[model samples]
Target: MLRRISFYVVIILFFLGGCSDEHGTSPTSFEYEALPAPGNFEITSGSYSLTLSWDYSPENIALAKEFFVYVVDPYQYGGNIYPVDTLTVAEYNTSKGCTFDKLAANMEFCFVVSAVDLSGIEGRRAEAECGTTSAP
Candidate 1:
């Protein structure tokens, strides 16, 4: 019986040791990780508005509601950060898409999206870039 108890204790310790915050550090706090690889993203078009997309990441997400998308320019836009938009959809389409109706015509906008994991952790953003597509 003593031997069995020792074995059980060691097993429990191992299990606990493998768990920690997403940063691979001590679990003092918990936060979501950025979208996989190409974190938040953006796309634009002269004819229409900009579109953005991202990936879900952090290995483990618990309760994310939405992602914030930002569009802007270096000189013309306010603070290089324009209209901030929230992406709200079923878990199936939140971090993997963008919007066009959210922009204006003839405007040069940069795109970037960040993954707000289910756990409310704001992950890193994908690199930003500028572009414009033909409007409808």
Candidate 2:
């Protein structure tokens, strides 16, 4: 009986020793700083498309790896926003804007642009710009 009790006590001590309140260090414990949002966001309507343009400071351009464009069809989904496209910093700098094509004619849409850093952290969205495509 004494030997069995000793074995049980050893098992209990082993289990208790494995449990601890302190948590191990996490692999992704570093904080991420978000990039700044793009400025001067504007949209121009086309036959069945919309062109979006925005400005970012040279300092911000150096930090951002890409830009994310989001769109909202307020008439159809009651202002439900969704990501539409992503443009590399080089692409944006070359064209100075992004074009969203193949849209419904004469329909109104809203757009916003955000900057994304190398770490894939997205910044706040710019002020929304709304426009209507030309009738086909």
Candidate 3:
């Protein structure tokens, strides 16, 4: 009878242990860090605007909560980068492009996209992509 009780106690303890967070790590034990940069950045021209496209970082898509799009207008400060938009994976169109409209026609613009994680961390941005909006 004692041996049976011991076996049941061991089984109960084992089940409780497995119920805890992964591998004995507490739920709050994990640390959040900035995600990696995006990849395959591309830009296209539109009438009085530009379109931006990029691939999620090789391993970052799973961790990324959203994406930030930045624009640098040469006409703004001879070139000054500014936050222009935010996008989610679901918003991508058939062409995989996010179009920024109402831009100054015939001007050059630069774009970069960064992944933002759940912890509100902004990751490194993809390489800058430059293009000129079609003349209006």
Please name the candidate that would achieve the greatest lDDT relative to the true structure.
2
lDDT of 2 by residue, 1-136 (tens): 9999999999999999989768877778677678877888889899999999999998889999999888876766457679989999999989889988898999888987899988888988887889899976
Candidate 2 backbone collisions, by pair: none
Model 2, runs deviating above 4 Å:
1-32, 73-78
- Highest TM-score: give the candidate number: 2
Instruction: List runs of model 3 lying over 4 Å from the truth.
Output: 1-33, 57-59, 73-80, 93-95
lDDT: the better of candidates 2 and 3: 2
| lDDT of model 2 at position 98 | 91
lDDT of every predicted structure (CA atoms): 0.59, 0.88, 0.78
Clashes of 3: 0
lDDT (10s digit) by residue, model 3, range 1-136 = 9999999999999999889865664567656577877777888898997878777643666676778888776677556778978887556423455888898888888887888887788888777789988975
User: What lDDT does candidate 1 reach at residue 100?
Assistant: 67
What lDDT tens digits, residue by residue, belong to model 1 across residues 1-136? 9999999999999999888556765657655434453443446354565555555643423345566677656676444665477766464264367666745566566766665666666656656777765556
Evaluated at residue 52, the lDDT of candidate 3 is 83
TM-score for each prediction? 0.51, 0.72, 0.63
TM-score of candidate 3 on Cα atoms, chains taken together = 0.63
Report the candidate with higher lDDT, 1 versus 3. Answer: 3
